[model samples]
Every structure is written in C-alpha cells, then in structure tokens.
Target: MSTDGRSAAGERAHDATGIAVEEGIRSLLLLMPRVVGRAKKMHIPEELQSFSLAPRHLSLLANLVFEGPMTVNDLAARLEVAPTTVSLMVGDLSRQGVLERRTDAADRRRTIVGIAAAHEKSVNDWLGGSARAWRAVLGPLTPEQRRLFVDTFHAYERELG
Candidate 1:
C-alpha cells in the first residue's frame, strides 16, 4: 500500500503518466532548435536589415504593429522579459524610425509605442510571408486536423503559465 490513498500499482500508473508527459515535452524541446532555424531562413525586408534587431525585438515589433500601441512596461510583461530590455528595444526602434514614442494623453508620464509609417509596409509584408509559409506547412492537413493542431499548441502554451 502507498500513502495518498494509492496502492503500489496505482503509484506505478501515476508515475507512468508523469513519464509519458515528460517524454512528450522532451520531444517538443528537441524540435525547438529546428523550428527556430527554419524561421530564420525566411526573407527579411531591406529596411529591417539596417536595424538588425534580434528575434525578441522582431517579436516585439510584430506585437506593436499588429496589436496597436503599448507602453514599455506592458510590452515587457507581454514578452515576459525585463522592463529594461523593452526600454532598450524601444529606444533602438525609435532611433531607427521603426517605432514612434508618444506621451499618452491619459497619462503624461507614460510613453506609448506605435509602429512608424515607414515600417508598416515591411511589417505587413513579413506577416503575409509568415502566413503563406504556415499555410504551406498546414495545407495538407484537413481543416479539422488543422484546427485541432492549433488548439493543442495554444493549450501547451497556456500550460507554460
């Protein structure tokens, strides 16, 4: 007999559940590097080449471009990075004219970030390219399968929390 109202065989079953879960997680971890490599091969716009932002900054820009303006602290929280990192990214983007910072009308002390007009075209182009690439990858799947796969991915990301 085992504690926690489980028999010895029950404990083995519980342990197997954990091992199987861990195995699935490890498999995803193994694929992570390859996914990143494939993503890096995608074309980037000439405008972005001069800025040379890292993957994190690119992700930040994507959020601002698509989701509308956000403050440095809000962006930092969303990206799960340090506030200083966001501040630095925003400063660099501001200088590169990829981002514009303005004082929030509601709050004078807060600075909100928005994608600059010059960079919007590039941002939209990148999003379109990414969508095409994803469609290519998922095109073979049935619509139901694609929906299930996307839902599973979101569940996994939520589990990270």
Candidate 2:
C-alpha cells in the first residue's frame, strides 16, 4: 500500500504513466505562450486592421472559406462555441465589413454568413504570414515529435467532446 492509499502495484503503474503525460503537457504548455506572443507581434496590414480580426477569428473565417456559407447555428456547432458567441462574432465581423450576412433564401428566418470579397486579398496576406510563423515555430521539432504533438492535441479535443 502507498501513502496515498492506492495498492502498491496500481500506484506504480499510474505514477509512471502520469509522469510522462504531465511532462509532455508541461512542454506543450510552455510552448504556447511564446507562440502566441510571436503570432500577436507578427504584422498584419493596416487595411486588414478594420476587419478587427484576430487569430481566434480565423477558425470561423476558414470554415466559411472552405465550406461556403453557413448559418450561425451551424457555425457555432462547428466552432464548438455557444450560438450567442457565434452571433456576437458574426455581428462584430459584419460591422467591420469583414463578413456578409444575409437571410438564407431557402429559409427566410435563417441567416447565413459568408466572407466579404473586398477582404480576400487581405485575408490571403494575413494567412500567409500566419502560416509561415507556425511553420517556424514547429521547425525545431522532429517530424515524429511534431506529428505526435498534433495527434495528442487532437485526441485531447476528441476526448473533451
């Protein structure tokens, strides 16, 4: 028996696995602050500034860009955020002229959101820099380590869901 009360065998197994998991999590946690700080410091053009977009906003925009127009409820589901949160983000982006919102013709009561054409060039520019920064951040990691890191995070997300 261990001091914490688990059987000796169980405690040994759990502690061994727990230490590795905690060490991996700690390394990843340490990396995030530096990556986020670097990302925020990276330049985005002044014209795109009014778009009032942030890295967090990119997920919604990317969904729209890749999946075409979608209703706020659908977007909220995809983003794993509350409908009200999606609505607020939509409202802000709409006011900034970063996105266009319209009542879906198929369902008059449902509003669909899509990216605005005017910001296409700016979005592309911003995404290019963002991608480069991410690549640079991961450049030091071994291929297997990088893949494992991404896979672990995805697994964590799936577990949460």
Candidate 3:
C-alpha cells in the first residue's frame, strides 16, 4: 500500500464527503414522490383511476407505447421491478383491456405485453402531447445547453441508482 495517499486526514475528508452526498441524494429521492403526486393530480386520466396508478405504471405504459411490445421479464428489468410484480401488473392491465399479451414468435416460452389495439391511439396521443409540452418548455435551449442538461440529468440518475 502507498502510504502517501492513505493519510488519516484524507480518509476523514473522504468519509465526510460521502456522507454529505448520501444525505443530499436521500433528500432528493424523498421529494420525488411528492412531485410525481402533484403531476398526477394535474394530468393523469380518469380511466386510470381504478388501477391505483403510479408513475411506475405510466412509465411502463409509455415504454410499451413507444418501444413496442416487451416480455414481462425484460420489462421488469427495464423498470427495475421484480418479475412477479411485473406479471401481476401486466395481468391487471390485461384484465382492464389496456394491455394484451401475446406469445413471442421467436421465443415460445416468453410472453410479450403491449397496449391493446383499442388503446393504441389514445396512448400515442397522450405520449405525443407530453412530448410536445416538453419541447415547448425546453426548445429554446441551445444545443450545448440541452446536451449539458441531459448529461447532468443522466449523471444524477447514475448517482441515485
């Protein structure tokens, strides 16, 4: 071990910095649910009310709407949820006729879930409108500014993860 880089003072400073970063991250994570709650009050549709919907549901729906069908396990991995949880959520959505499950052509053992035909247009419209709103809000930013914003947000996400 190199002694020059292992001073007691350096170790204490590093510990203090780590503690402060963790506290800051904890505070930010705590605030996220409140922010999501406010946004839901502002924009979530009445049709989704019976499902005890959360942002996680919106996230799942959006992913399916935009990215096309995905297997329950793949979706769980993307959403950072358990496979059983995803299966339950997909089962509920399927029951509501919002999602449809189909056997994957290449993988007989896997079931791919996607928005039902009847719900496709509505899902696309909602996501499109949200995209429009985001564009309106952030469109004025220069390319450099937009890049910086994206980079910083991704860095924040990495830290939180």
Candidate 4:
C-alpha cells in the first residue's frame, strides 16, 4: 500500500499524461451510463416507433442520413463491418420501407442504398437530437483535439473487444 492510498498495482496506474488511469476509468464509469441512458431515452419518431430499431441499426442509419446514398460496400467500410452484415441490415430496413435500394447508374452491378423518401424526415427527426448534441460538444474543439477524442474512443472500443 502507498501513502497515496492506492495498492501497488493501482500506484502503477498513472498514464503518460500524468493523470491516473484509475481516475480516467472512474470518470468514464460514472459518466458513460448516464450518457447511454439519456440517449436511450431519446424519443423515436412516431413513424419509426413501429420498426423496433436497435442500437446496431443507428450507425447504419446515421451514415445514410448524414452522408447520403452509398453502396453496401461503402456503408460496410464506414461501419467497419462485413458487407454481408450490412446487406442483411439494409435488406431488413428495405423490407420495413425505411430504406431504399436502387442500382447504381455508374455500375449496374452495384446497388446504392438510401433512406426511403417517405421515412427520411422521420429518420432525421429520430437522429437529430444525437447529431445536435455531438455537434454542440465537438464544435468548439480544435480539429486535432476532435481527432484525438475520436481516436481515443476507437482505442477504448478496441480494448473492450
């Protein structure tokens, strides 16, 4: 045990930035649940409430909502998942009438997926709160800082895996 009140293992938890790793872990543990709970409480637009969309679907929808139409390969690349995985999600949403799939004009073999016109507003409304919240938080950050923040999140996610 150390005078700092940490066990020897804990005493070794200092990060390169000089902040204790345990402190960062404690802060995130206290903060993450509240953030996730608030996000889970966000209202699903009436038109979308029937689809029973899950969290996995959000990243896919967000990509389409923010970046416009793209092929499944593009979405899979951006989502960092297998193309078959994205294809299944796209197929499911398409059947639900939440997504539209059309052959890419530039490549007949390729299909471009997009939010269905009828559901676009609903998807936008459903995701708008999160987008605004992220923008509000990240807007003031320097580009480098924003990159670091995002990279840190990626590192955390990979570590979890």
Predicted structure with the largest TM-score when compared to the true one: 4
TM-score of each: 0.62, 0.60, 0.59, 0.86
Where does the lowest 10-residue lDDT sum fall in candidate 3? 8-17
Native-referenced Cα lDDT, model 1 = 0.81
User: What is candidate 3's TM-score against the reference?
Assistant: 0.59
All candidates: CA RMSD (Å): 7.3, 6.5, 8.2, 3.7
Q: In model 2, which runs have C-alpha deviations exceeding 4 angstroms? A: 1-30, 54-56, 128-151, 154-161
lDDT of 1 by residue, 30-112 (tens): 99788878788877888778888788887897677557899999999988899999999899889989899999999999999
Candidate order by TM-score, decreasing, is 4, 1, 2, 3
Model 2's alpha-carbon lDDT is 0.78
Model 3 Cα shift for residue 101 (angstroms): 0.2
TM-score for candidate 2, residues paired by index? 0.60
Model 3 misplaced stretches (Cα beyond 4 Å) = 1-38, 45-51, 134-151, 154-161
lDDT of 3 at 147: 92
In order, the Cα lDDT scores of the candidates are: 0.81, 0.78, 0.76, 0.90
| lDDT comparison, 3 vs 4, better candidate | 4
For candidate 4, the clash count comes to 0
